[model samples]
Target: MSMHRTVTMLAGLLAALLVGAPAVAADNGLTVLAAPPASSGRMRLQVEVTDPALQKELRSSGASPDRFRVAVDQAGAQVKAVDRMADSSRERSYTVLAFDQSKSFATSWPQAFDLAEAYADELGARSGNHTVAVMTFGKSKSTHCEETTAAGLRACLARVEGRGTDQPVTRLKFYIQEAVREAARKQPLPRGGSREVIVFTDAGEESPALKVKDLARDARERGVRIHVVVFSAKSAGKGIAQRLDEMSQLAEGSGGRYIQVGDVDARQAVTGLVGALENLYWLDVAFCGVKPGQTSDRLSVEALVGQTPTAWSAPIDFRQRAEGTATAACPGTVVMGPSQAQSGTSAQPGTSGSANPPGATPGTGSPTQPGTVTGSPGTGTQPGGALGTPGGTQQPGGGPGAPGVSGGPAGTPGADAAPSGLPWWLIALLIALGLLLLIALLVLLARRRPEQAAAPAEKPVPPVAAQPAAPPPAAEPPPAQPEPPPAAPAAWKDPFATLPETRLVVSKGPPGLEPFYRVHKSTFTIGARQGEMDLAVNLPQLSGHHATVQLFKGGNVFVKDEHSTNGTFVDGRRLNPGERVQVRPGQIIRLSQHLELTLVQPGLQPAEPSSQVPIAAAPPSVPATTPPSAEAPRPKARTLYAPARGDDE
Candidate 1:
C-alpha cells in the first residue's frame, strides 16, 4: 500500500476513535487532553520523567499528550473525580510526559510510553485536580509542495518523519527556509505554562530555507525540550543511500539522538520518543574508538543499569572519532572534544582531570569550566590568533631577532652516527653495467631453457608428406569469457514500484521445524553436492565481532577463527570468520569438534587445463596408496585436454 494511504487510514482510525470511544471517567477535568497551541494559552503542564516502563504503557493505551485520564481525590479521599470530555473543535488543555528523553539514541519509542505511565502514576498521588499532556504529532501544515502523490509524499515525509524508515533510502529534502518561515508563522506564542516540543527528525536540513542548527538553538532558547527521533539510512550501493547517510550525520551534528529504522518495531520507536519527552534515567555512553572495535564497524552496546538492559545505541563510525574523542568505554555518550569534556565533567569513571571544591572528595570530579590556555615563548600565531603555526616553526620568545626558545635548552646530540657518502665503486659498477647492454642481452638469450624457446619453434608441423594431407580444417576463433554478476539489489523500495523479476526461492522443510537459516545467527549443515559429505556451519551475525576463514589442506580440518571484538570458533580452534578461505578438495572442514564437513571436489576452484602441471616421477618404487600431499613434487603446470595443432596456420 502507498505510505500516504496508510497514513490517511491511520489518521481516520484515530479520528474515529476520538468520536466513538465512550469516556470511561466522570467529568471533573479528570481526563486531560492538551491540544497543540492555537495561540499559546496559560502555561500547559508538561511532565518529564526518567522511567522507561511507564512511558511504554501510556503510548500503547492510545493516550496522546492531549488526551488521557487522571483521578482527583475528595475531602476524605473516598470520592473519585470524573473527566469532562472536550469537544474536538474546542480549545483543549493537556499534560505531556517525557520518558528518558535525555538519552542519546536513534530509537527510544519504548521510553516515551514509559514516561506516559509515570505521569499517570504521579497523578494518582496528587491531592487536587490535575492534568496530563501526552505529546504527539498533531497536524502537519497544509503547505503542499509537489509531494501530494504517494511517492513524492513518502520522499517528503522521509525528510520530516522521525525514525520512520532508512535514511539512505529516504531521498527527502525540505525547503529549510520555507519550513522555518511556516513553522514560525504557525507556532503560537508560549503560554507561560510548561510545554515540550518532542522533535522527530533526522536533525538535518536540506532545505535552503531553514538552518537546522539555528532552529535547534532557537528551540533550546525558547525552552522547548527538543526530544529528537533519529532516522539512520542503510547504505548498500551508490546514490540515495550514500546521500542519506550524509544527511543523517548532518541531523545528528546538532546533538540530537538518532534512530535508524531497519527491522525495528514501531512500538519501540514511540516508547523511545516518550522517554525523551519525559526525562528518563537512560544511561549515557561513549566509545573509546570511533568505530566499536578494530575491525567491526558496528558498536552494539546494551546498558546494564539497575541490572536491566536499558537501550542500545545505533552503530557509530570510527571516522567520527577524528572530530571528537569518546568520553569513556560506555556507548550512547556524545563524542566530545577535549575542551567540551572538561566543561561537562561528571562523576563518570574516566575523564582527564578531577575537580574538588569545599567539602568535595580529593579524587571525585565535578563539572568545571575549561581553563584558559597559555602558550610558551616564541610560539607562532595562527590566522585566528592561536598558538602553533601550520608549518614546523617556532617564533622567537624575545623580539623579532631574539631567540624565543621556551622549553628549556635543547639537549646535545651524540656524535655523528655514520658516513653519509656512498662508496665510489658502487657508481662505477652501475656505469659498467649500463655499457654492457648488448652483451647482457645475448647472454640472457643463450641461457634461456628449451621450454622458454620462441613461439615459432613451438608450432606443430603437419604430416603432409606422409599421405597428401587431408584438407586443412577451418580455424575457429576462441570465445570470450563472461563478466561477473553485479551486487544484489535492495530488498525493499516501496515494493509496489515494480514487479518482482527474480524468484524468492524458499526451502520447505518437515512439519513443526525449528526456525532455520536465520539472517545473522549461526547454523550448521552437511554438504551434499560432492561425493564426500562435508559439514559446514554458517554464522552470519555474530556477537558484534568479525571472523577470518582459513582452510588447512594437510590437516583434516577447515577452521574459521575469531579475530574480532567477539571471537568465533569451530569446536575449540578459533578460525577467522567473515573472510574467504579456500578448502582444497579432499580436505575436511572443521568448526572445531562443534561442526565438521569434508571438502568436496566439485566445490573447489576448477583446475585449469593449461594451468595444472604433471606430477613429478616418484623416487624409485613407492606405495601406490600414498597420500596426495606425500606424493613426489609435481610441475607447476599440467596439460588438460589440449588438441593437436595444424601447421598451416
Candidate 2:
C-alpha cells in the first residue's frame, strides 16, 4: 500500500481503539465557555479528514456535519443554548475561518470555545470577589491581571528568560508562584471568597531556587486557587501539549488546576480553566505526631457509604489501610510510602491502620541515652546519632518493632524485644526434646523383645557363615540433588521504574542575603553553614487538612512547626489562626527563622497529569455542580483509569 494509505490505516486503527467507549451525550445540551488567555484573544476551530478514502467518499456524497451546545449557571439559575455547527467535508478537516464568529445550530468545532467564552464573560462580569494574580518574568514588565480585566486576563502567558532556549520548568514555576501569591495577598480577599492565580508560562523550570511547599500551603490557606495557562511549548520540538501537561502538574499539585491553549482554540482553553476551577473538590486534613524520624507509612483514610467503599485517601506508603469498616476495598485510598503495590485487608471505616514493617525493631518509646540513637534526648551534636541502622533496626515483637507499631523510643527492653534477634527459645526447646529422645532410645535397646532373638538367629548363622558373604555391593544413596544454583539473585529492579519523575516547582525560606537554594522534587532542603538546617516541604493535604514541618537532628523531631493558618499554631498558641502561617520546626525560631510555602510537584503518577484527586469537601448530597456550561462544552473527557475500588486497600 502507498505510504499515505498505510499511515491512514494506522490512524484509523488507533482512533478506533480510543473511541469505542460508550457514547454519553448529555440529553440536555452541555453549556460551554471559551475564555482564552488575553494575548491569544479570539479563537478558531478545525476538523480534518485524514483518510483519503473517507474524504473521497464525502466528496462524492456530501459534507459531514457536527453540532455543539453551551450553557451558563450562576447561583441556582442555569441557562442553555445551541451555539454552532461543524462541517467537515469542505476542507481537509475544519480550519479556523474567523475570530469571535457566532453561529446557529452549526459551523465548526471552534464554536465550542466561543460559547464557553461567553460563559466566562458572564462569570467574570460578576464583581470578582477574589483577586486573580497574573505574574510574568523576562517580559511582562510588572503587570497585574486584576488591574485590567480583559487585557490582563488575556496576557496570561509564560515569558521566555535566561540564555538557554529550552523552557526551564523552574522559571515557569517561580513566575507562577510569585504571581499567584502576590495576587491572592494583594487584595484582602475575605475568607471563603473565590480567588485564582493564572499563569501564562512555558512548562520548564530551572534548577529551583524558590520554596514551593510554603507557597502552596499559603495559597490553600488563603483560599486562593491557582490556574496556569501556557502559551509556549518546549524548544526541543516538543508539543505545546507537553508543556501544558507540566503546568497542569504544578497547578494541581498545589491544589490548583491548569490547561494548555496552544492546541485547543484560545476560547476552549480559557473556558476549560474557569469551568474546572468551579467544579474542583478541595479538602483539608489536620495531622499531628507526623514529626521527623517518625513513620509516615501505612496510613490511609476513607469516606464510605455503608459497606461499599467509595472515596479513599492513603499516605505515600503502601502498608497502610483505610480506617473504614467496609468489607469491600475502597477506590480513594492513597499510599504514602515508596511502594504502590500493597495488600488489602478489611478495617473499620473512617479509621486508619498500618501493617507493621517486616522485622521492625520494638523501641522503648522513651528517649535513649545520649550515646545511643541520633535523636536521643541528650545528644549534643549533629551528623550521626543513636538511630537504627540503614536497614532499619528490629525492635521487640509486640513493642516498638511490631508492624504498624508507633509511640516510643528504640531499644526499650520488653518481653517482645526483637533485639533477642532470631528467637532462641525454639532452638533451646528442640535440643531439650532431642536429649529426651536419646534417653528413650537407650531404654528401648535395654528392653528388646525376647521373641525377636529366638526367631532370627538360626537362619542367619546357617546361610551367611558358609559364604564369607561376598561383600554386598555397596548400595549408593540417591546422588544428593545439586542444590539448584541459587536462582540468580532476582535481578535488582526498581518498583518505581514506571513512575513519572517528581519535579519541585515551588519553595520558600526565610529571606536572607546568603540563602540556600536546593530544590529536590517537591521539597526544598533549607539551611546555612552554621545555623540549624531547615526545610520547606509540600505535603499532600487531604481530609486531614493540615501539614507540618518537622526538624530532626538525629533520629527524632526536636522541633515541629505548623504553617497552616486557621489554627495550625504551635505550643498552644495559634500562629496564623485560620490563615496559612510559618511555624518553626523547633520552639526556638520565630517567623523570621521558621519558613513555609506551598510546594508544587509533579503528578503522583505519569498518567494523572493533575495530582489533585477529586475529594468532596461537602457532603455528597450537595448537588452535582458542573462548570458554567457556556464557558466550555464538555468534549469527550479523558480521565486516568484509577484502580478498581478496594484493589489496593
Candidate 3:
C-alpha cells in the first residue's frame, strides 16, 4: 500500500480502539466544606458541585447513587455512602449583574459587553430557577432588568447599548452596596436560595462617601456575595491594576469571587459561577483506615459523570473515633468503586456560592462549622481562622500540641493553593435560625429513631414450665480493690479532639470566624497569636496573649486578663490585672476593638434584666451572669466532652 493509504488505515484503527476506552478523570470543581471528621465512625461532609451539567444531574431524580464513587488516601478506609442533605441542598438563587461603563474599559468595551451578555444569557437559563438583574454603571447607572428570568434577560439584552463615560468617577463601594441592598429587598436569602452580585468591570473607583468595609458588612448581613469578572488585556496598565485591586477587595470582603478571564475562557468562567450558585450537597461519608486517637491521613473522593470521572479530597481533621489507647481500621463498608487521582489547579474558589460564610445553612442541621475555611496559615490579621498548625508538634495519642493545618490533603504539582482559605464573610449565616434548625432536627430524630428515643420494650419471661432454678450459694464478697491513685492535682484528661460543652459562640467577630469553638481545656487561652493561643482570633487589634477563659468544675466560668495590650472586657467593664470575675451564660466577651464572643449555656439563660442593669447599679447578689474568659478556679485540661456532632450525631 502507498504511504498515504497506510497512514489513513492507522488513524482509522486508532479511532476504533479509543471509542471503547474509559474516559479520563478530571477535577470538576468539587468544593468540600471540611469539618474535623467524627473522631471515629464515619465522616460527614457538606459537598458542593460547581460543574454546570453535573449539578443538574446531581439534583435530578435520574441520579443513580451507584454511578458515584468515593475513596480515601489512607491504606484501608474508603467512602461508604453519600447522602443528599435535604436541608443543605440549595435550590434557588438570585444575581445582580452590573457591567462597568468606566473610562478604563474604553479599549475592551466591546469585548466586555460581549462577555457580559454571554454570561447573563447563560446564567439566566436559571439552572436551578435563579433570577438575575442586569444593569450598567459609569458616571451614572441604568437598570435593564431589576429582576428577570433567563428568557427575560435575553429579551432585555437587546436594549443594552453601553460604553465608558467621558468622566468616570466610579463609586464602586456604593455600587456594590446598592446591589446588595437590591438583593436584600428579596428578603434574607430564602432556604435553598443564595444571593450574589456580579460586576463585570475592567476598572473601579471608591468614593469617600462609601467604603469596602461597609459594603462587606452590608452584603454579609443581607446574605449577598459580590463577584467581579475582570476582562484584562495582555498589556494592562497601572490604572487597570489599581482597579483590579479595588475589585478584589470588593469581591473578597463580600464573600464572592474575583475571576480573571481572557476572551477565550469567558464562557468557562461564567459557567463555573452558574453551577456554583445552586448546586450543593451533604455527604454522610464513612472514612476508613482511621487509627484510634491518631489523626488519620487526608481523604479523597471520586464520582463518574457520564464517561468522565471527577475527584475531590480533604485534610484529615476528623477527630479519631476510638478514644485514648485503641486504634480502629477505617470502616471501608461497600468497597470504594473507583480511585480518583488528586489534581489541583482546576479548583478555583472565586464563586464557591456557599453562605456568605462565617455562617450556616438555615433551617437544617448542617455542618456544625458551616463557615468555609479560607484563611492562610499565618498571623491573626483577618477572618477565617481555619485550623492551622501552631508551633508545637502534637504528641502521640491526645497530648497537647497545635499541629496540622486545615484543607484537603496536599496535592502534587498544579494542585490548588486556596483550598482552606475561603473568605470568612461567606460563611456567616443567620445565627437566630440555628435554634430552629436544631429543634427541627431533634423532632425528626424523635420520629426516625423512636426506639433510641423511647424506653426499650420489656420482654416477658417464658412461663415457668421449667423447675425454678435453685439459688446458687452466696458468692464470696469481691476483694476490695486498692484505692485508685488520685488524679494529679494540676492535671486533667482532655479529650483530644472532641468538642467540649463549654463553647464560645462568636456573636460578634471577624467575617469568617468560626461561630462556635469547642473549649476542651479548663484554662483555654484566647488570643491573636496562631500557635500560642488555644483559640486564635484573626483580628489584629488584640495582643498575642489577650485572655484566658477558665471553665471550672462546677460550671462556674471566670476570665483573667493576660495583661493584654488591648484589655479584655466582660459585658462592658474592662478587667484589671489579676482581677478574676465570674461570668455566666448570655454575657458578651469583647476582645480588643473588633471581635466579640458570647458565652452560650444550654438551658442557661442569665437574668436578662440583671444583665441589662448597669454593673455598678445592680444588686451585688447576682454578680455578672458571666465573666470575660479565664481567671480563678483555674482547672487543668478540660474533662466535659461535647464532640462536634456529625450529621449522624
In terms of lDDT, which candidate is strongest? Answer: 3
lDDT of each: 0.28, 0.30, 0.51
Per-residue alpha-carbon lDDT of candidate 3 for residues 326-369, written as tens digits (9 for 90 to 100): 23322102222123334311222111212223222221212232
- Tens digits of per-residue lDDT for model 2, 1-649: 6444444455554444333211211111111111111111111111122234433443455432211100001000001111111221111100011111111112222333343334336446643332333233432225423432433333331121111122112345555555555544554233222345655444444434655555554554444455554433222232322333445545554445454443345565555544333222111222211223332133222222222222232221211122222112111111112211112222220111112232333233222321111112221111121222111233212223322222223222222322211236643654565555556556555556454445545555454445565778878898777664333322323222233322222233323322221121122223221121223221211002233333222212222223221123334454442333333323322222133332222344332223353211221221234323345433332322221222111
* 448-555: candidate 1 lDDT, tens digit per residue: 546654665576877665667689899998899798555443232221112111110113322332222111101111321121112212221112112222322222
TM-score of 2: 0.29
In order of TM-score, best first, we have 3, 2, 1
lDDT of 3 at 1: 62
* Per-model TM values vs. the true structure: 0.24, 0.29, 0.33
Better candidate by TM-score, 2 or 3: 3
The CA lDDT at 306 in model 3 is 36
